[model samples]
Target: MMMHRQYLIDQAIIARNILRVALPLQRLRASATRPTLPETPTRFAIIAGDVTDPSSSLGDLAMFSALMQSLRAQNPDSIFTIIGERRHTIVVPGIGETPVEPAWAGKTGTLAFDELIRQHHALFVMGADILDGKYGAALVQRIVAYCNHSVLLGIPATMLGFSFNRNPRAPAVHALSRLHPHVTVNIRDQPSLDRFTRIVGVLAQLCADSAFLMPSATDPITEPEAWIASMRQEGRTPVGINLNAHALAPAIAEVGMDQLIDHFAEQFKRAGEQNGLAFMLLPHDLKSQSGDVSMLQALDQALQRKGFTHVRYASIDQPDKIKRLIGLLDLAITGRMHLVIASLGSGTPTLSITYQDKFEGLYQHFELSLEHTITPMQCLTDELLRKINDAFMHRHDNRARILSHLPRVKALASQNLAIATCGHTD
Candidate 1:
């Protein structure tokens, strides 16, 4: 039954891709024969969280980068202004400065927040995190007061991948809806969309996660030679484990990272004793605050205690780290949404340890089995190992299934960019 469902989804995806390419080509040819259209300078204000904080913020930053690139390609005259943490300034070039602290507070710094909005035609407000009641309300009021168009690119209720334990600034969002008819709200998940529609009295448009648009390897990306060589020497199936121990969800705690790692380490150690394939711990978000590095270190220590010497760690700072990490994986079992996204994007089979609805939605979107993906809070190691083994056994089929959706994901992102920039009229 699952195979039949997957086949039907694949057929629909192929049909969608065919239409996307053909329709765009026809539009291009028609435009070419027409008189040249005058170029317009569209200023975009992307209200985002601090990029320096590499938690869920990385997903937003990556999306912003992709959107900026896409917009530049379509409209060279367009200018993008990012309002977030000042520390993020170094990573994103050409971003105009804004006061970082009290992000929700209205115009409490040297920068004239009101004046900046008056100059721009549209404001693209990211996740509701930036919309804390008083501060968010003030910011929204200022934007509505200044800009002709404003949109809240919210995470849809259907997108089960994001961590949404904290209730977003509903009062502020409500205020914006009441103040301006031009104000629009959209979410990434289906359930959120339904609830939002109930609150706002309007059906929100559902969109795919922006992370799908993240850039792939631009350079000669390859796995670390040292890591790959060491794996071959150990003769154990190289499995990448990304466990989110400090996750916001308490359910994740129930899984007990120590037990999870110990079981996998022992299993790999036994395999290594016979044939030599070692398990490698790959921490996706390894920053100090995220606590991924510390968690991995603890797991490393545990593995060492078990006499497992073939384990390796992938440094996040390394060049082409994402590509390198994904490439090295024979299989990936991860709790981080982006790691799963990256692995699937790179055609690497992955078993997702989901704590939120976003993971389930993504699996549904790609027509993958939810049974293969588990919630850590469940702590079913036997089931997890079975899923991991299944993923490896069906690695080729899974990769092909994931690859089939990439073109569609990219096309949807392009369509969203067009709507974000060109669809809004001043």
Candidate 2:
């Protein structure tokens, strides 16, 4: 009881401080502009708590970055107020570098009660995973607090490029349903949009996953160093492999980790022997304890245990560089969403071992067959090798199909930005 009361008191103080600083910050922003301008436009952005994250943010930051580019192109007058403990530089696809900082760790200072948030035009809440209001989730508290407060204040709040794991009851249909015309929600897949509109009674606009619209990553262009030139020259088809350690380890804990690693290695070895292909391990994250970089090592050790040592591993933290490497492959075998996004975005053929709805959902969005997907439960069976062989054999045709579908998908993603900024989809 005391803890809950203290929480409310802290919130009250924070809100009061923000309210107190609102007018001065408004005055400061008002002073910066031209006399011909009518009013200063600002946006309140609520990103996931880990704004500095690379892998866990998944490919959502790439989409958010693309959205930032669109906002800069269309709504030049807009400034942003981001909410997080820490902020860092993220390469915004085509727009180069943008700092995603609205607050620093443990310090409110002058920007503490952000004027843009207090007297804001719109609120944007997004992340790869947080937008899914699942139970026992931490970030949804921020969304609930911010959106509810903003809606009550008559500020337009938008949930941008997110998915819902389940219909939220704690912050369910009430606040959003009541906000009516002021709130806007854009989802990346038809499945998510259908669920939101059908079960939750909130209207959700369909947009291609924002990752599809991110500008060609500079990682491949900027890095210049070849992470895998020797292997590329070997005259055999190269396959890019990304295993999602975070999801796979926890979800498949019932299966021993060593056995799981051996299963993948054995399959890869079989695929190599059958198809005359070389494999390259690509790491998508470096900072996290359980990120792709560390996990790649574990898989490598496992492969060594089985006397397989010829497989090459590539360590890269830049999303763009990862995309470039994925493009070099004849086929991508991945459990991670961003790896799949980078592979297919560049029209690199892919076969995914999916653990979440996001993968199957996005693949469905592209009208691609999910026959190539295998679950962890199906990993011990022969289905893994079958999909691997089939996907590689028909990779060129799949690449062409992906390329054919891309322009249309990119345009729809752009329409999502248009609707958010200009209130029109076309």
Candidate 3:
């Protein structure tokens, strides 16, 4: 049934794309004839919003950096700019910094929103938190209204399959769509594109998650043998676990911190005991003050009560370091979408404790059975345990299946980039 629905969705998108192309040619041609502005070399701006938070994983940053490299290689004249929060001093390699405008101050600085839009040829908006509430839609609309030649690469929360409510600021998005037709909006998943199109009356092109296209290493981490030896010496299995305790204001109504911590801790205990794996609590977003310290403390206490002595916790601040930790994992189970993507992309077997639709899309894209991945909020304990055990038993096969799908996802990303830049396949 899921396959059939996906097929129908794909067909609908293709049909919409055809209509969008055929219908817009005349309008585009008329706009094109007005004046051929002299082609200045293209400059790409990655408007990351916040880049220094502990919650921002290294894998995600690496993938975005890789995208910048690809763009620079394709167009050597292109320069890349990163507009980030004032406190975030951490930088992605190959990206130049531009300070982000404070929300309350309302756009005044050396790099004013209007001036930034006028200077850059393309824009890539990469973070998940940026799209919460109507901010994402409003931001895109603002860019479209002021910058005629720019594209907004949005990673909408709806990509994870959560519904996007029409907030009070939605009218701003609609207004911009009506006022500036040249601004292209691209989303990470199909459902988000569908929702955005339904609301704004402009078809949004679908693109695969950029994380999947990240370059894999033949040997990404150093001294793997030493790490493995240390684990063996300690009589531990070195299992990696990523628990997302942080919730943006928007996510609280859907799931709370206490429930999330309890759910993960319980699952970790069960999986560790059954599989002989020691728990390594991996915190993906350390900057959000989600009470990770308390959560870890709680898990440690739970492990002691259960008579499990092999447990450790690690927090990472750099993307390369995160990649190394992921490489060290014999197996990983995660709630964060990017963690699962990183593990799978790195050839590590993973079980996704799903909280959204993006997880389902990723599993489906890899042709993995949905039965193996659990939605903790919805599943019973018995069901969750059964799935975990099944994942362990079939980890090898599932890892192979996921690796096979990476090329297709990468190809899709490349194809989308071509279409977005040139309006046709390269």
The candidate that achieves the highest TM-score relative to the unseen native structure: 2
**How far in Å is the alpha carbon of 390 misplaced in model 3?**
2.0
Give the TM-scores of the predictions, in the order they appear. Answer: 0.69, 0.78, 0.70
Write candidate 3's Cα lDDT for 1-426 as tens digits: 986885575455434423432233324434432222224536655555343342255545665655665666678776755554343444554554423432111233222433454455555555343342343333433333323323221111111111233341343444435523334444555555565567656545565666655554434444443555577687667767665453222233356655545555576678778887776666665554644445666667777766776676665554445555675666777766767766776766777776534565566667778776766554334565676677788878877887788788666555334413322110
Q: lDDT per residue, candidate 2, 1-426, as tens digits?
A: 986885575465445434543343444345543112124444535454354452244365555656666676777755554555545665545555555554422224234534435555666766455554442223343454455444434455666666655544433333345334445677877877787677667666887766676656554443323434555576567788877666575434766766777787888888877887777887665556645765677777777777766577776655666776677778998777767888888898788876546667778766788887777667777788999999988898889989998888787676555433322110
**Model 3, poorest ten-residue lDDT window?**
153-162
Off by over 4 Å in 1: 1-39, 50-57, 76-79, 85-88, 93-103, 106-111, 128-181, 184-186, 189-192, 198-200, 220-226, 229-237, 246-277, 318-320, 420-426
At residue 211, give the lDDT of candidate 2: 66
Per-candidate Cα lDDT values, in order, are 0.51, 0.62, 0.52
Question: Whole-model lDDT for model 3 versus the true structure?
Answer: 0.52
Better of 2 and 3 by lDDT: 2
List RMSD in Å for every model shown. 12.9, 6.2, 9.3
- Selected candidate, larger lDDT, 1 vs 2: 2
Can you give the lDDT of residue 82 in candidate 3?
Answer: 56
Better by lDDT, candidate 3 or 1 = 3
Q: Which regions of candidate 3 deviate over 4 angstroms?
A: 1-42, 49-63, 75-78, 85-89, 93-111, 127-181, 216-225, 232-237, 246-263, 291-294, 328-330, 379-382, 419-426
